[model samples]
Target: MAEQIELHEQAPRLKSVSSPQDQDKGTSQQDDVDDTGITEASLTLEEQTDLDARRGQGFEAYPDGGVAAWLQVLYCFCIMFTTLGGVYSWGIFQDALHAEQLAPSSTLAFIGSTQATLEGLCAIPISALVARFGNKNVAVVGAILSGLGPILASWCTKSVAGLFVTEGFMFGAGQALCFFCAATLPSSYFSRRRNFATGLVYAGSGVGGAALSLAANGLIKSIGLPWTFRILGILFLAINLPCAYLLKPRPIISPIHHGAQGGLTWGPVVKISLLKDIRFVLVLIGSAVALFPLFVPPFFLPLFATSIGLSSGAASSLLAGFNLASATGRIGWGVMADRWFGSLNSLLLCLAANATSTLVIWPIAGRVGPLAVFAVINGFCAGGFFSLIPGVVSSLFSDDDLPVAFSMIVSLWAPGDFLGAPIAGYLLQAFGGPDSGYEAYRPAIFYAGGLGVFSALMVFGARVKEGGSWRRRL
Candidate 1:
């Protein structure tokens, strides 16, 4: 039964029906506040549309399983196929650098790290930039830059520094641009299936790494490195170009407020104070902390395998188990979130499983059978760590506030992504048996497990904070 309260006068403010955790903080303000903390205004005869006019189009109703919607998912996969293909395939390029002889191993390693770091760091600006310029505009420039970066890198085969700028900085920036374009749009298209859609989108990276690795291996052999890069450069644009054309933001209405025109300003995009939202703040801390160690396995697994007495070939082959399992985990976890677990719970499950695998299985994975098993377990559980992100973040905000919530939450991953593996590496070097390749990685393994421990605990805290108790599912 629904009842209406009769007001003597029209209220100028909008009431927020926000999460349980926020009610206390929300009450502190005398004025009604939107989820993002902006106060509502009295309707003006000068020219004002009401709340209905302010809703973004797609979230009100998802297209669900339309051909057009599914096509966008496919397009996201293509973007991942190319962008993360490059990200994951950095090892191939790192190996090929020996032929160029322009830089030492330490110097060459920077090239890949720089590309990755830039990709992560630039995401904050790119997410907000999408509000100003449409997804297609940003994505097209990304496609152009992605293709041009490597094409230009091909010309500078003799100069490591030139490759650094072209392949590292330019390529990474382009990936960031194209990446957020695909990543941010999917949430608006499917509410019930948002996790499933996002899962497929992120699973693109794993799929890309597998596909591109084989292609890169063969391409480098048949055509040679420079030509291979040129071919890949061409391929990058070919894939992203169509995808960018199709990517679009849901129609939005930014309501007009006092003393200004009705348009998004640089102000909202640049605001970090939004971190003041407790829900947003906890999510940021939890995500960054989880990712700080969550990223270790992909970077160190093969190397760790070799240290355990496995042949280099066998160690490399083991990576397939992790990658395939990751793709499966992503889709599976997304389904779980849509069905039963919900975002925070599903994420907690993943982090717990990942941490357990790292501590118990990975430490003893030196044996061939144990190594394969650990790889499978880690990949399956840890894969959802990224896939579940859209769910958790989406739960924190209403449709109106989704853009800022998404941008701010995801921005945390940049620093975590860049720093995780390096921190793990330092631990290995410091604690591993002296001169024993990966034998002394015990301390590093513990470090990874420790990160997982804290990550899981922190998210549990956030989930409880959101829902107010264990009796509720978040």
Candidate 2:
């Protein structure tokens, strides 16, 4: 009776688009836990309403495996391919910049770090905009900025400071908005196959990195760096805009938990109360720490390869191999998460293994063979961090809170992402820079592995908190 009354009251704000039969079917579907093992029953009544309203019809079931649903995955692939794909291939640019003696390795690293940092830093407001104006609108704006930033950066390639604003700040902001949408929207479309679908979406980064790494290297060889930036800017605009447009998410109304924004209220766009939840807090911290090591190898692999006597072309191939391995791991880990291990459990294993690969495999890998092995191992395990996080976030929150919750969680990643590569660069520079030989890179490698270990421990705690025992699938 209370639910019915609440539904009536909500009618003005959330008009039901489904017929009575459709609503009844949706209600039944909502009552049961899905294959991902998440249930609406666990949510508060308000949260439940918010979830229902977000479905557009206030009760529509997920499309699951329909054309519309799969197309979203494809769209997200393109977005990540053009945006994060390029971000992952930052080594190509860094290598070129290093050759030119533009600045210290640390300073050059800061350019990429700035872009990575903003991916987390700007997420809160962008997510709030997602909640308020809808996902498509925010993503469209991101598409524009994603392109514009690079186009602008082409003119500023001569100045590191200018690159900071264009490539670092602007590009990072655009990636954040686009990534949030890509990462979160597929969950709205899938229940049983949520992990797998998200894995497919994130795999775009690996595939894009693999392809674009080679492409960027080739472009740089053929044309000058400035022209390369111009071509990439045009590429970003052409691809990201269409994908952003075609990527339709379920309609999201004002989130009551955050309170509706009125005339210029200056609080966090999505005021998350999840901070009070210890499990969420732990997961948040773990995810942030995980970021500390996630990009280190990608950013430095080419330089590291060069130190070990590989040519520039070979270094590019190694980076591409790492990305390709990561792509495979994204899909493979997602399947494992769905079939055998739970998302949290899978994430725990991945982080631990990722750390082990970095700590154990990397230090001993002085030759091409060992280094190549480490790259593959590290890339595969590292991919799990990106793939399973959506599933983990989905497990913790109701659908209505997902966009904000995920954004808020990742926003904390700004510090880790911002510092990870720069710290590595500084470590290398402190030990005598990249010219100081392969031994100079160990400190940074240890730093990255240590952060991964810390992240794994945090994840373990969160998992224990969730299931009360390590034996459970949760």
Candidate 3:
């Protein structure tokens, strides 16, 4: 009797709300409620409606393997090739600036050091800028700056100050932009294939470095530094043009009730991630420390070879081999990471290899064959470390937080880079010259290897705490 009375009373209320438009809306609401179960504690109808509005702002679907995404990847390859090629080509430039230009070795070293420092240090501000203005704008500006730096450098005289401005500051700025933009783009386009995408993008650096090595070597012999640098700059601009067009941000849907202008703040996001997440901190620290020694070999390998009685051509060849090995390593490790091991495990394996190769192989590389083998091995291991870091970082943080996370990691890396080369130089000085019959590079290698080991242990501890091997899924 009570149920019948209630139904009788509710029929008039239902009838009153049952116009054609109201009926359609009511049906949709019920469907939505069924799709995501409604509880008494759930948001009010207005709140739910607002969320639906916001969800509509997101992209309908990502073009995972679309032409645009591939083009973006290609553009990234070119950008990396130009920027990292320049970084890897530092040996040739240093020699030219010292021998042909009659600049002091220490002064030229400072130029390279400054460029390296700024490249790492600028990541924070540039990443923030990318977050605000989007990657295309940041990349275009960075590309222009990078393209123009070498062109301007071609006109510089033999002054350290000139090199500092053109090579260190300007070129450094350009490289930072290129690196950040390339790294951030594919993350927005692919989820399942992110590791592969990143590997492909980073492989660009190795390819660029290797190709530029041969070209720069011949150009230095035939045309000279000025024309060589100018030509390289033009090539860089060409590569960056396509990337500038292809890189775009993923679209985000706004909740219905809130305007697009109003969004969540960074504070709550960070607090929530940090309060509950330990992986983020661990990955960040491990990556930063592991990265400390990565650049050291590339920066000093040619010098190390030359000091060991190798000719310039032979030393350059060793550098080329290292870079080529690195290219192979990136692809191999990336594929393996995506298939067998997760990103964290891949990082651990790479770091262990780096530590082992440096500690065991490099210290004993006295003979030419041994040295060449060691160079290739070291390059491969270090390349794996580099290629795996971004994937590992992504595994720890959400997409919205990735820029800030990467920025922070890059910023922390500045000190590591600033110290790595100078410390290597100091180690060389402490050992007297290569003529002292004592290997200076041995101590430096051990130090770097030790840091790698330490980083690996940190990852291990974190993995243990998380109740899984590093190879396990996050």
Candidate 4:
């Protein structure tokens, strides 16, 4: 039911004046807070008009910064810690599967790639489910699948195909459900501090990844892989089930926020007209291309360390350190996005830095000292991608259009995430099998780095489309 409230006897009208540059770009700056008490700097003239029309309609205002909002952030952090944090720790399992000779390197890469791909691809349908069923209900399903998949996978360790179904498809599906629901909510909860809040949310992945990677290594050594998975399953259930219960989506009139009463209808799944916008198209392409090289390092870094004669424990430690640095990067980038460089600008800078580090550092880092340095720099740079994307999408679209726009951006990440590491694995095998020297890995590194460069260029193009001035905080 819509809340009924009395309006002030003499309600003040919010106003904004467009500058010449804003006129050229077609965006308006809200000089005064809206009825919701939020100042939206990126609102288009049409969006501003829509909000004005909604005033005095008895809609609840955005809490923006309150206990309820921060609690949601905390819940989202725990969700990411279990979902993507586990995915980021795939290097530990990759090394183990390789040792067991369970499958070819390319095939082994698929197990990780499949889960990662599904996380991206499944977001489209999950968004619909969230719209109809509500965030909490959908998140409950996610928690179940995420916990159940690994538990079942423990029984299917002998067959590579079995791992695909349990670990890859099932776990991937769960991640999509939980991750997308949590990721999309921050935009609704906060406007001024959205970037910073989102940064803190995503930083969970790095922290979880770092912690779980170390834990998995110890568990694998102490008991075994199967037992380690069972323990992880119990942990996922305990953490996520409670978080799912606490998911209190802000009451909104939009279809996606309709929860159970929304009736099987999807409001704006993709907004087909957005395909025609050059800015949207450019950012979409860049987002897709960026992932082409994103997983290459995380998937192979442990193997690379071992190839250079580091002990297994030492190699795993490097990955853990890398993830810790990634956590720092997420927070740092988020602050930068909110305080200094705007989201789009931050994304472009991060991608460029990510590509540079991969190209210049990895190939020459044959020893422990250099490899450790590469991990920290590259991990921090790569971490920015997760923290900045939502802000960039929000900047380009209206609040009503956010669900569809952000869905499209994440959905496109599937192709690159699915294929990047497998291609690298295939290249490694083609050049020479495991018996071959580290030279076998060079082609894969170059391929990943080259794609990173291309992704940065595409983002640069998007930045140009937005207005190429470096002085402007895009």
TM-score of each: 0.85, 0.84, 0.83, 0.84
Q: Per model, how many backbone clashes are there?
A: 2, 0, 7, 0
- Model 3: weakest 10-residue lDDT segment is 1-10
Q: Write the per-residue lDDT of candidate 3 for residues 278-319, one digit (tens) a residue.
A: 766676677778767777687777777877788878888888
Worst 10 residues of 1 by lDDT: 1-10
User: TM-score of model 3 relative to the true fold?
Assistant: 0.83
- What is candidate 2's lDDT per residue for 30-86, written digit by digit as tens? 343432344556656886677566544545555678888899999998998888887
lDDT of 4 by residue, 392-444 (tens): 88776655556677778889899988887778888988989445756778899
Tell me how far the alpha carbon of residue 280 in candidate 3 is from the true structure, in angstroms, after superposition: 2.5
Candidate 3, which segments miss by more than 4 Å at Cα? 1-63, 251-277, 469-471
For model 4, which pairs clash? Answer: none
Q: Which portions of model 4 show Cα errors greater than 4 Å?
A: 1-62, 97-101, 251-264, 433-435
* Worst ten in a row by lDDT for model 4: 1-10
lDDT of 1 by residue, 260-318 (tens): 33333453543465566676677678778887776688778777887777886786677
Query: Pairing residues by index, what is the TM-score of model 1?
Result: 0.85
Clashing pairs in 1: 432-440, 433-440
Native-referenced Cα lDDT, model 3: 0.70
Q: Which sections of candidate 2 miss by over 4 Å? A: 1-56, 251-272, 468-471
Cα-based lDDT at residue 271, candidate 4: 72
Candidate 1, RMSD to the unseen true structure: 5.8
lDDT, each prediction = 0.72, 0.78, 0.70, 0.78
